[model samples]
Target: MPSITINGRPAEFEEGQSILEVALAQEQEIPHYCWHPGLSVVANCRICLAEIWAPNPRNEGKLEPMPKLMPTCQTMAQDGQVVYTDSPKAVANQRSVMELLLINHPVDCPVCDQAGECYLQDYAYRYGRASSRFEEEKIKQPKKDIGEHVLLYGDRCIMCTRCVRFTREVTGTEELMVQGRGATEEIDVFPGKGLDNELSGNVVDLCPVGALLDKDFLFAQRVWFMTKTPSIDGITASGDNISVEHNNGTVFRLKPRPNASINKWWISDEIRYGWKFIHDESRHVMPMLRSRDEWPSPKAAEAWTASMEAATKGLKSDGRLAMMVSPMLSCEDAWHLGQMALSIDPQAVIGVGPVPFNGEDKSFPGGYTVRAEKAPNARGVRRVLSALGIDVLDAVGMEKALSSNTSIDRVILTGNYPSEWVTPSFADAVGQERFLLLIDTLPNSLTSRADVFLPGATWMEKAGTFENVDGILQSFEQAIEPVDYCKSEAQIAMDLQSALSGQKPTVFNAAATRQAMASQAALDRFVSDVTLPKVPQTVESDMSIIEL
Candidate 1:
């Protein structure tokens, strides 16, 4: 093991890891670009340089402690190494490099996509000199129409080359290449085509500067105003965890979050732009009331009970009950729905609803992505169904159960697909049944046809867990308030469960819910005393693991 001192703090590391790796491992701040651990170490940006202190010549063996400026990313840490990430000289060098990069940059942080999280923006605030010294006119370049999906504003480039390298090595698209020389350098797509590659939008994210911007997200909203919520990318079978940041109730942008075990550094464009469907003009907003039934405001339990009682006056508990838990619903919500199903009869048929998809699963750069299975959490729904000992029925079964000849007369369906995921025929089929109860985040055919409709919270407003194809459970936190009077499906299902089972509503708290879930398990497979990971804000450096 190589030992190092970072800013007077003792640290230890593997022999070959760079100083940047050691510093970041210890959570020390160092600006970086073009330094993804998953990719080849280019060390292109000089921003990560640090002062490596060493011994005086006479007392070299004992480390007398004088320092020298070095590229922290390029220097390998060896035994008893010492590094200063905050030396005056090192700090000055970083500032000067930032100034040089800023010389030709356009003054557009106000509208730029790389606002809050931009390394240049962060470095400028911390390491840069107060003002720019350049008197020359800012450089300008034409927005090169790259592919259909990408527009390259080469002038905004910091020359990170992350996109170019990604195209060449990861996607093998080879549609992008650098052209011209030095100051005149520009990015150009191959002639006769735009960025037709599957992994194109990724360039927009890879660009450290606004050199590449999603034409769709450009100027949509000021970055600072948006709130970020962690959610799983619903577009893929791998179920990559993503951040869905929105302004107000409108979804503004998407980005990848680090999930070391699953989606390491990238999420596909399907996961990226799927929110567009959420903004679909006909996307339902308010709760729909059954035509023959009068619905009341449900701000509280009494109002909700009044609403339910008024809507289902003739329906009885013995009526064959069905609850369709959408794959889009979170695991905790699905579990609550499972509880609701058993609460109704303890033998009710709980069917999995429609999973929308076109055809083949699409693979993008770095790995397979955006599965043909359009739904994000089908596996999670199945997990709930299996755990609760309910029959996990699919779309085909749902259709069969809703037919006139079937015993399932009262059915509850939750549909939140961006498009018409549920068929009109299915809606008509369920509608003709004795009772159709609809729960959805957006308006769809089934919601319109149901006898009673319940509003659902969009991904931004809710917190829950999702299980990917491999059975790894990833948790998401709520970032925004519930959209338009809708409560989280978790809250709805729990309330319904409490109504059915005669127990108090037990909302899902990440830590408490796990224990509750374990208690519900009948065997060793579902038993675990494990606790939730520390919330990011509460994590403490002093709590580092103690070796046994």
Candidate 2:
């Protein structure tokens, strides 16, 4: 390991490691658009320049600092090396790059998708000079449609080839490429081709500037208005940690949080745009009691559950009472729910419902896409169900058992499906004579038939762990207050337990469930490899993306 001075602090790196790697590993952030961990290093963007002082060969013994800067991404770390990123020269260089990058860029901050988090916007505020030296006819290029999913404005581009590299190296589509040289270079689709890959949405995230924009996410909402909530995406197994940014309880965009073992930096488009369902007001928000029933308060909710649990308080057989576990649920929520169910009815029939599979798990030049499973936490739910010595019936068997008369004495259905996962006939036919409980985030026709309607907290207000398709259990933090009468699924289930067993369920300790999940087989797998997806690669630079 080479111990070097970074930002006036000691930072050590393995021999031959780049300065960028060491800087980012130390939790010191540097912003650059062209360097993604999964792709080959392309140091075309000179925005990451930093100053360095090394041993002078002419003097033979003394340290000699370079007047000109070097690219931190391409420069390997050396022992006893002294680097200054916040020096005057480094800041000036960054400003110059921003000025050059902005020369031909149109003023579209109000309408561009990358406005708030864009590198240019951030660097200009922090390291950018007050005024530009250039006063010439600026180069202008017509905004072109690069692909089916992406709109390209060449004039606004900083010549960051993130889109081009993503096509060539990640999706292996090679749909986007750069044409011309120097100041005239621009990104575009090949002769007759357009970017139509399933994962094309990722390019928009890759672009540090507004050059590549998603038509779906374009001008949808201002970034400042959206509060980011750490949540899980149940679309696929690439159990990606997600930042659910929303406004007024409505989700606007989703992006991958850097989880090394699972998704590196990019989440599949399935997850990126999946939040649209949350915006479709058809989502059942607030608790809806059985038909012709009114919404209940926290106190009223407990009373109803008390009466319902009192009826079946003495569950005869373990398998007589069934709890329907939804795949979209977080692992922590599922674990606690399973514990509550088992404690009430030791012979509880635990059924894991529905693991929706799109088709095959496909791969490109980048890491393979685990696409078979649509639900994120199926693995975690199944493992938790099996841990309780219960048989997890498939979706068909679950529906069949609920439909049959002798299958269960009391049944609990937990789901967050955008639409009804269980059919009306099955829901209506199941609990005509028996008591039925529905635990859900959104309301559905199936919920209307439930005797005990417990409002489940959406992903925004819940802090729990979820295991993705890769069996990687990731934890997320709560973002906002629970909408209407909804409480976290964990707390609601705990409240039901409190009603039956007289234990206080109002205080939910997510840490306890998180620790429990950490021991399980499926969740234990998250302790694998770790990596930094983005870092500064410029030496002689003190510029960083400002924390907004």
TM accuracy, model 2: 0.82
Tens-digit per-residue lDDT, 283-387, candidate 2: 554554454356445565554455346433533344478778888777667777888888787767677777776788887678747477777778777876676
Error of 1 at 115 (Å): 3.3
List clashing residue pairs in candidate 1: 147-194, 147-195, 148-195, 284-443
Quote the RMSD, in angstroms, for model 1. Answer: 6.0
What TM-score would you give candidate 1 relative to the actual structure? Answer: 0.84
Would you list the C-alpha lDDT of every candidate in the order shown? 0.70, 0.72
Q: Per-prediction TM-score, please? A: 0.84, 0.82
Q: Pick the candidate with the highest lDDT.
A: 2
Runs of candidate 1 with Cα error greater than 4 angstroms are 50-70, 84-92, 130-133, 147-149, 292-307, 357-365, 424-433, 497-513, 522-534, 538-548
- Best of the candidates, TM-score: 1
Per-residue CA lDDT of model 1 for 1-548, tens digit only, reads 55888888888998789888888898887788777665567777788877776645567457644445777777888666677768788788888889988888886787677787587777788888899999988778787777655678776788777887888766777777777887767678767867776557877877777778887787778776777666767555566767787887778878877666676677666677776765655554455566533334454454456545543442355668777888887777787778776767676777887777668866655654556777778887787677788878887787777775367777778876666677767766676646776777666656656766777776566776666767666666776676655677778777766655567767656444544566655312233422122354533443477899
